[model samples]
Target: MGKKSGKQNKLIPESHFRLTHPSVSPASPIVDTHTHLASTFELYRHKYPAGDYTTVFDFVRGLYVPAGVQDIVDVWCEAPVRPLWREFADSAVTEEGRRDLWGGMGYWFVMGVHPHQASEYTDAVEADILEAMAHPRCVGWGEMGLDYHYDNSPRPVQQEVFARQLRCAVRLGKPLTIHTREAEEDTERILKAEVPKDHKIHIHCFTDSPAFAQRLLDWFPNLYIGITGVITYSTNTDTSTTVRNMFAVPASSPPPRLRIVLETDAPYMVPAPIYADPAFVAPDAKGKKLPICHSGMVPWTAGFVADLLPRGEGEGEGAEGWDAARVMTVARENARAVYGV
Candidate 1:
């Protein structure tokens, strides 16, 4: 807990969100499948300008470690790869280093040029990413995909780089972490052509149409949809619809075998439930709630996901329906299966 304010319910930034979900504890920890830890740290520092956190590791240890986040797959998807990633990756090489640096929480990473940076993809950038691949903590080769939404990079360039990175990742036999937005047709075509059906893939922060998600699920057996706090947003009906479709099995049928994983994608997509919590009384002077999202807020997202699951005949006592704990456990296992971290 942080330094409490004068008000009874209000909590300070240092205290962070109170973990209210009964299932989210150290005994049943969760993994953030996709997050940008370095970026999150920077945002945290900015939010708490006078805060005491001195480093990214310190910030994470204070905020996320207590939230029962056992592991994180930090994304390094920029053309000029951040130099600090090497420091973070090296810190997890040994148990002692991890204990000293990451507070015993496992830190893994995936490296690729994001579609927004496709225009800057160069031989030097590829060379740098290739070097990172050999690091012990580099689990996959991605977040590389087409993003037609922003069109930050030219369409042709995005396509070329997407295929190029896919080829490299496939040849290396590394799991792929893809980021596709509004370029579903090209994304489907490229993936089907370039990536093998059996390749392990994580579609990070999936908010696509149900038909698109279904097609990908049908095509790839090892692929899993990454669910973030965005699922809890009222405006993003696609994520909710995608999850609902997965759980829309007949009442007599056994529970659906969900192929999903949870992530924060922070410091973005703060789950809506946090604002509703009584403990969350620390809004800014302008009435803005928590400005940054972190791994600790994942349970709220899980709680939201649990609500989307249908309870059937065999789902209460003999067979439990989807719950927050089960969601965390299932996603943790899926994280291991897909990323091997």
Candidate 2:
């Protein structure tokens, strides 16, 4: 969650509020390790805050493809609903479109109920998720963990659900994408207790303390940290009284380059307040904010990384120099680590 200020939310740095300029790229393959193209369409249809999902494919074809993003893992978790969704997304592809637009019309899939969908974790749901995993595209086990702020499900039930998913990942030899929020302590405890040896784990949109991050690193050596524009757009109003959130690792004391990944949780966490601005308009938009954040923004996110990186390390590489190239190198390595791509 971000810091709330009077009616206008204070835009967090990770959110990239003032970023209108594009960073220079070095022709590297950057992967949006996490995103939801389908969800963006849905959010826009409902008229959410940044609900202009039209022209997403055109944007990707023109902007992101030229920008160098190779693949976007379209993750899902609801058992009953997602199987149909997967088919729906798949059916839209023409043979040529599949190869050209989607690079094979294939997406890395993650299966496990999110905390919000925890209510669906019944016997039938479990069966459906298991069946989905059998598909060749299923790559990981979740975007699931604990969310204390929105106690959508009881903590115990969330834990049980998480444990079962972890077990499923272990059996399948697939990595896991985790979503941890205020429930960091319990989330960590359950992970420590349930995650098996050789299990691959990625804590997506991590917002815990650095100490907790360190502990997780120690406990799960294979664990990785996902960085997003959220760092720039963090709504944490406490930035005035306290330092930024704990999950952020200064680029100075960098984690292993392989332990980091880049993500754009589009249609949902549009990086900064700039999306709320009028001048930065979305194409084909009807007075609505851009819902599917163009993957081109990853370079802007890298600018924040360059800003945080220690001085004397040629900081020029971020905003002006090799910033895009540098972030892409680490991001691709992270993908390789997580999926052995």
Candidate 3:
């Protein structure tokens, strides 16, 4: 993809993509299948790229929980140069306090190297992610896969890393959370080749052509699309239109409700333009919203999705209105099936 022009860039603010859909009811809960809670502000706050554990915890406590998000499947990277499992174990210890604070329950973490950092992959890193999978809280083997936007790592190298991670997930009986940008063809090819035909996979932060999305869905029954704030904050009507054409109405060409999932790649992709506002003090200590994302954003996302649903079919028979609760429940169940949670 080309670098965004300044004018085009202005149209897409940090939080402009937040889902604004209202909830069907206040009592329902939504599961955010993808997040970067462990990293939070500490991970993104500085150029040095080291996180302050205290700040990370506090952010999760203050913002994420209040959002009404019940559960999260967090994803992040560790120093591949170091012993992988040791770093993961240390992360568990450092984060134990914060994890416990989420209503006194532990949170799930997925360990992997981001495509930008894919060049660091070594035998030890692979071994470590594999070892960490057995930990009760370590649910999957990802934020793996391709990122063509930056190509921070070579294309070949990224492919190698993705294939390796897919093999590990297959061997360990774990699901996958993938990252793809501008590399859709290669990403799909790799998924088809590396992951077993029946493997469960999710393309996180999915922003691609409708045709591509449909092809993947039709070809891989176990694959899913992980939607985030982008679906809501997109000012570009064309993008939304494409989404509607592909997944909104199933009567003409229906997309399976069970193939969709929700996520908040928080601290990075804040849903609303809330981050750009001067008065928009975040719920976290970093002067940002809470780090851990919960289901509070569900209504906003679901509302957008409801708009995409074919209104004619669900009309006056109580089908006209989009039920946020029903959509969220489907999202929750879809995520569980994909992740085997």
The RMSD (Cα, Å) of candidate 1 is 4.3
Candidate 1, residue 109: the lDDT equals: 96
Error of 1 at 236 (Å): 0.9
Model 1 regions more than 4 Å off:
1-12, 17-20, 249-255, 282-287, 312-319
Question: Which candidate leads in TM-score?
Answer: 1
Q: Which one wins on lDDT?
A: 1
Mind giving the per-residue lDDT tens digits that candidate 2 earns over 1-341?
23333312322221222233344344456577777766754644444344222554543454456555666766776545565546634433456655665544234666788977675688888777777677666678788888888888887888788888777777778788998888878988888887874578878866666667667876886887777767666564322111122224466753323356777776555555435444446343324444346455666565555545443333332323335466677676777788665
Give the range of the ten consecutive residues with the poorest summed lDDT in model 2: 238-247
TM-score of model 3 (CA atoms): 0.74
CA lDDT scores, all candidates in order: 0.85, 0.62, 0.64
Per-residue CA lDDT of model 1 for 125-169, tens digit only, reads: 999999999999999998899898999999999999999999999
Query: Which 10 successive residues of model 1 have the least lDDT summed?
Result: 2-11
lDDT by residue (1-341, candidate 3, tens digit) is: 35645433333222322323335334556677777654454444432223332454444454455555666777766547234333433444445543664542235778788889888888877777777787777778888888888999999999988888888788888888888888888988988887777778887877777677777877887888887777776554433554565444545543334367877776455555334434344332234343333334555565566567655453222154446666677677877788765
